[model samples]
Target: MPRVTFIEPNGTEHPVEIANGYSVMEGALNNSIRGIDGDCGGNCACGTCHVYVAAEWRERTGRQSEMEHDMLEFAEGVREDSRLCCQIEMSDTLDGLVVHIADSQH
Candidate 1:
């Protein structure tokens, strides 16, 4: 399993192990990590799972898709590193990934 660290707006960190092929959002929801509502059930339709991919891991996480990019327009505190966790699949390369849950997600 790979691990992902979700940092909340209040600076709390929840590190959870996730199975490969699962989305980052699933890892958070399954582990009860706060701040990631995942309102769309891991689908890219909702922006509730918005997070900021750490700068160092951006390339590995890849850029947001067109749908994801468009959907993020509705999210709060959008930024260059902003991405929907639902769109980022967990994998060996993504192990130890770190993301900051958007303040609005809290």
Candidate 2:
């Protein structure tokens, strides 16, 4: 399982252990993690699952798809580290992943 951590705007944290192979968006939506809306499910069409990958985890998470990149341009509260949670593939390497929900989704 991959240990996922969701940080709230006020610094509250929600952590869950999810099976590998699912996207980070799925983990948050399924677990009711209270941040990610995943309005378009795991698809990259919606920017509702927007999140910020911890600065240090940026390289480990790799690059976003072209479509995801374009969609994120429409995401609210975007930052240099912003990424769509749906684009993140779950894996043991992401066990300690830290993400913050988009302000729009919250």
Candidate 3:
């Protein structure tokens, strides 16, 4: 399992351990972390799971896919680090991943 920290819009942090093969969105939803509304059930169809990857962990998370990029266009506060958390799958190398929930997701 890998540990991921989801930071809420108000700056609160909810850190939890997620299974290696699960997506970040799934972890957040399963742990009852606020601010991530995985409305599309991690299908990447909805942009409600938007989050900002911390700079230090961005490279480990990799680049967003074209489909993800398109969906993020509809999200508020989009930035270089903005990513649809549904696309971020957990792995052993990403043990300390940190993501900030977009203000609009609140």
Candidate 4:
């Protein structure tokens, strides 16, 4: 399992242990972390799960796919680190991953 920390706009942090192969959106939803709507059920169809990957962990989280990039265009506060949580699958190497939930997701 890997640990992920989701930071809210107000500076609150919700950290949880997530199983390998699960999506970041799943980790947030399962832990009852606020801000990530995951409305499309981790299918990348919705941009409600938008998050900003911390600079240190961005490389580990990897780049977004073409479809994901297109979807993120509709997300609020889009940035270089912005990513759809549904598209970020958890893995051992991503332990201690930290992401900031977008203000719009609230």
Please, what are the lDDT tens digits per residue for candidate 1 over residues 71-104? 9999999999999999999999999999999988
Q: In model 2, what are the clashing residue pairs, if there are any?
A: none
Candidate 4 lDDT, 80-104, residue by residue in tens: 9999999999999999999999999
Per-residue lDDT of candidate 2, residues 41-92 (tens digit)? 7879889888988789988888887998899988888888899999998999
Clashing pairs in 4: none
What C-alpha lDDT values do all the predictions have?
0.92, 0.87, 0.92, 0.92
* Total clashing pairs in model 3: 0
Candidate 3 C-alpha lDDT tens digits along 1-106: 7999999988898999999989999999999988888999998898989999988898899899999999998889999999999999999999988899999989
Local distance difference test, candidate 3: 0.92
TM-scores of all models?
0.97, 0.94, 0.97, 0.97
List the candidate 3 regions with Cα displacement exceeding 4 Å.
Answer: none
Clashing pairs in 3: none
Clashes of 2: 0
Model 4: CA > 4 A from native? none
* Model 4 lDDT-worst window of ten: 53-62
lDDT of 4 at 72: 95
